[model samples]
Target: MSGGVDSAVAAARAVEAGHEVVGVHLALSRMPGTLRTGSRGCCTVEDSMDAQRAANIMGIPYYVWDFSERFKLDVVDDFIAEYAAGRTPNPCMRCNEKIKFAALLEKAMALGFDAVCTGHYASILTDVDGNKQLHRAAAWAKDQSYVLGVLTADQINHSMFPLGATPTKAEVRKEAAERGFSVANKPDSYDICFIPDGDTKGWLGERVAPVTGDILDREGNTLGQHDGAVAFTVGQRKGLSIGTPAADGKPRFVLEVRPISNTVVVGPKEALAIKEIAGNKYTWAGLAPEHPEVEFACHVQIRAHADPVPAVAQVVSTTAVTGIDGTVELRIIPAEPLNGVAPGQTAVVYVGTRVLGQCTIDRTVSAVPVSTPEMIASASPVPVNA
Candidate 1:
């Protein structure tokens, strides 16, 4: 439980259902004794206390598990590394994969619990053949199946989402108020939990050493200088120091981010169009799709808020593959154009709300004029660092 209204109501519902419930809150970090209490987000000292209080109110046992070291190494460090390599990382997915389902489930099993339950909006159901499947939450707007798509069949088999049937955020708050939970009126967290101010560039700069680099136009002309290449992402138009006006007098878009040379490439809006995307680190929920031969069609989601686009998916072998880290790539051709597909982000595939699989974007295929060859070549090779 994160001491939120949903989790508090979930604990109450579990107890009302007569199932033995034990609330476990993983302590992801602790302040350095310098930061004050009630600081903005969860995993803080006060948040843990709120969880404990809710558990007590629900008349169940509660405890705080220290997983700070693992969280930092697995989630935080990986997030920083991905950005430094000029790719966007999904920390929520990482947290679910490494901490919530993996670590917390293992610890719960060791404690002799039959299953672990949470307040997530998604649901898990069993088919006639005894195979487990994930389903969408009743609340359409608050559905989080995209982030939770990385979960495997085994994890879903032992998980319970009590609030999956709850349709709206308003209803959740009402339930919590009826149950006498104090956090019903608490505001929901809107940004990344760790970085309270939502300053990704500032947070990354402080976490890792910054390197100076050049900002170049599509014609290979130096537009300006950037503090670090990792500070920008593809399709971003703000905070760019390129004061040079485009030939057409229109705005420019970030075409690429180069980590090795520490440079950012800018171009006209038309240069940002991509027809195909190749992804690595592919993870299917159950069966693995055959490579290079069998192609399937599904809805592919490139970003969290973007609408799912119809696409055909094909499995391809990596150009450079060895026995140790051999990778499988999934190629997606969107049925229509997508505006800002970024490399190093996840491409989550779904059949309705049933998560088919997910993969990390390794490359984007775009056609450019021969005159801009120098600019494209100078922008770092595709999937060089990811």
Candidate 2:
């Protein structure tokens, strides 16, 4: 349990179901203090106490597992690396994929556990043929299946989500309060646990060296200046300190971030319209579509909260990429042109509400060719949206 109302209530429900349950709280940091300062904070001592109190009420054993080392290497470092490579990554997905499911699940099995259960808002269904599939929770607003879309079929088989069937957060809170759990009224964590202020740009600035350079328009005209390519992302609309306004007065958006040349490229929103996205490191949840490896229709969600759109996904072979035989690619035709389809972001595929599979988007093809942005030869940077 994360010592949150949802998790505490989940534990209570598991006990009510007559299963032998033990509560575990992950100590994800080597230095955890109640005042660690973030969304959920770090030094889980106080959180552990809250968990212990809930475990006491549930009358189940509780323990704290230290996975700080593994979490840093797998999730934190990987996040920094992706940004340095000019890609935006979903750290929560990495935490789910590497820490929660892969590493933690392996440990659970060794300790003789049948499945790893959590408070994630998603449902798992088993077919008559024993095929397990992941689906969105009934509560659409709180659905988190998009992040869990990275799980493979094997991972799905070993997971459980007790809150999936729960109708609403209000109901969960009510139950927690009725059960006399103190965490029933705890404020929800809204920032990244490691980032107390949720200032991603400020945090990134400390680690990524600044290389002041040009911010340019589609026509190669210098619009403004930028501190470093890593500080910006695709689709960002503000902070380009370009004094000159466009002749047409249309707003500009970030078309791309190039770490190599330390360049920021801005253009009209249409330049960001992408028709096809090819991804590497694909994972499948269950059986492939009828054609097996050929392109097939499915609904694709590019970012969390983005509506699922019509698309086609296929397994494609590449002679250039050694070792791996092939990679999965999604040819997405969004209902409207897709903007901000960033590399390193996840593209989850679904059929109906069931999660079929997902891929880490690596490249995209615009609906039409976007002009190569012109470069500015000087520097006078400003904050984004400033």
Candidate 3:
């Protein structure tokens, strides 16, 4: 339990189902604040205490398990590494992938638990063939199926989301109030819990060695300079330090960040419009499809809370430097233009509300009119999804 209203209600429901439930609050960080300052944090001492109080109210056993070492190695280190590589990554998704599900679930199984339960707003469905499947929550507004898309088949099989079918978060809060839990009114955490100040750039700047680099335009012209390539992300418009407006008097956006070359590529906003995305490091919630090479119709979501857009996607083969020899590659062609899709960001595939699979975005085919020879050569040929 995360010491939130949703988890409290989920634990209540689980205990009410006549099964013996033990509450385990994961201590993610070794050093945590005594109290959360804002609505965007978790894993503090106050949060752990709240979970313990809820466990007492439910009359169940409670324990705090310290997974700080593993969390630092997987989630925290991965976040720094990805940024150093000049790619944007979702740390929450990494936490879910490496810690919450992989580490916690495996430990729970070894401790003799049937399934690891959570309060995620996503559902579990039984397919027609008796296989279990993951689906969006009934509460559409609160559905978090996008983040949980990284779960493997085995993890999905052993996981349970007690709050998945709930109508809304308000209902969960009301239930928590009725149960006399103190955290019913506690706000949700949004910022990176470890970075309580919410200054990600500042936090990273201290840890990563700074390297000065030149910011370049499409024709390899120096526009400005940046302190470090790790500070900028693709599609970012601010902090370019590029003096004077463009000849067309248009605002420039960050088209790319090449860490190796120590160059930040700047261009017009239209340059960020991408028609296709190629991805490696794929993860599926279930088994692979019968035909890996077939192009299939689906909705593609680039980030959480963004509506799933109509798109065609498929797994394909590639010999590009970004792809692996034996690893299957994902190719997505959105029916509409997509902007700000970045390398290292996840592209989750869906059919209606059911999640199909996901891939870590490796490259994109920009719809921009002009490109340098380097840009043309860097991207491999994109296979049409449909």
How high is the CA lDDT of each candidate model? Answer: 0.77, 0.77, 0.85
Query: Compared with the true structure, what per-residue lDDT tens digits does model 2 show for residues 178-283?
Result: 9999988887766566666678999888988888889877666788898778888888888877778777898888877766677787877777787776565677
Residue pairs clashing in model 2 are 32-43, 33-43, 38-196, 220-374, 238-385, 239-385
Top model number, lDDT: 3
What is the TM-score ranking, best to worst? 3, 1, 2
**True-structure RMSD, every candidate:** 3.4, 5.9, 3.0
- The CA lDDT at 352 in model 1 is 72
User: Residue 354 of candidate 2: its Cα lDDT?
Assistant: 94
RMSD score of candidate 2 (Å): 5.9
- The TM-score values for the models, in the order shown, are 0.90, 0.89, 0.95
Candidate 3's clash total is 3
The better candidate by lDDT, 1 or 3, is: 3
lDDT against true structure, model 3 = 0.85
Q: Which of 2 and 3 is the better model by TM-score? A: 3
